[model samples]
Target: MQMYNPEVLGVSLRHIQNRQERRVCEVMTAELADDEDFCGCTLCIEDVYACAMSRLRAHYLHRVSIVLKRPPPNDLEIREEVCAAIEVVRLRPNHASVT
Candidate 1:
């Protein structure tokens, strides 16, 4: 039995790294835990650069990977999430809720 649970949402990142995802998850969870939350989108530079160097173009394989140059961002209000998804992601209504 769960009582008083906040809504859980998904945001796509480039790649799921141990160190980086930990930070991103922590920050995002905290932000969403609050009331009156909407949505967020995350763009990764490392993912862009990685595919840029690879044989594949940024749009083909269809997935995004993540690298953490800085600490996770706090309280991102995402109206739209647009990035290079090479691997695969389930694009849904929530992803478009922002912009």
Candidate 2:
């Protein structure tokens, strides 16, 4: 989870936060702006959000490559599946929501 670029994950998490409820990705894929760091520009906010959506799509389908360098093992995969897209939901203070 910590493996992907921070800009990608941070923006995605923020987008999920704006949604109606907690979500877990069935697939997750990361996308970048054709122009580097275009995500930082307010004018391209929608583009940034779309990039995040791309990542979310990748996870829901169980192809979580955005934040992982290699495929995860069974236990980790199960964990990701169970906990995917949890950004929209707040967890207990001790729960570290974004594991």
Candidate 3:
């Protein structure tokens, strides 16, 4: 399956968002950037992202006003999940090798 990008579709779905997803994306990007040995291919990156996202709790905010009232996710938790995801994808990547 392909990763979803609303920007690529030229559409915005800003009405609702899983707060954990944004955190996962940020943490995953930083973690992978620091790991030089890890495969940064599209498949690997998407796998890592998917893996991380699945491990985190989903906190959906349907309105911008609610976002301000909600407590943000813990940074340490996000880091831990992202790190674990990195290892999982690294050990068992979907593809044999990057082209």
Candidate 4:
């Protein structure tokens, strides 16, 4: 016989995003904002984020205490990925004319 767990029904679990990854994405997006050549549309930003996320390892901490205990490193690896993604977006932006 197995006991039923009632807590599972009322629990609203949320995935805590890594602050460092957010920061990296923010910085890259801000940098791209200054770029007149590249489009700063919502889809484009999401594209950039997707690209960077694919290359960067996610640091999901289950608890807020754990997140607060340590600070994330300034990762150059993520920066490089964002840089490459920027180039890709620049070369083939979604806003390009359908010629």
For model 3, how does the per-residue alpha-carbon lDDT over 1-99 read when each residue is reduced to its tens digit? Answer: 686655537666755688788789888878777799898888888998898888887777765455365466689988998899899988999998665
TM-score-best of 2 and 3: 3
Which candidate has the highest lDDT of all?
3
TM-score of every model versus the real structure: 0.24, 0.19, 0.74, 0.64
lDDT of 1 at 95: 41
How do these models rank on lDDT, best leading?
A: 3, 4, 1, 2
The alpha-carbon RMSD values of the candidates against the true structure, listed in the order shown, are: 15.7, 16.3, 5.1, 7.8
How far off is model 2, as Cα RMSD? Answer: 16.3
Q: For residues 1-99, what per-residue lDDT tens digits would candidate 4 score against the true structure?
A: 585443556774445555556766676867786787777777787787777777666666566455344344456666777888877776777776434
In order of TM-score, best first, we have 3, 4, 1, 2
Worst 10 residues of 1 by lDDT: 77-86
Which lDDT tens digits does candidate 2 get at residues 1-99? 355332464454332332211232222222222324222333233333344344432322223324545342343443354333222221212233333
| Candidate 4 lDDT score at position 92 | 75
Compute the lDDT for candidate 2. 0.32
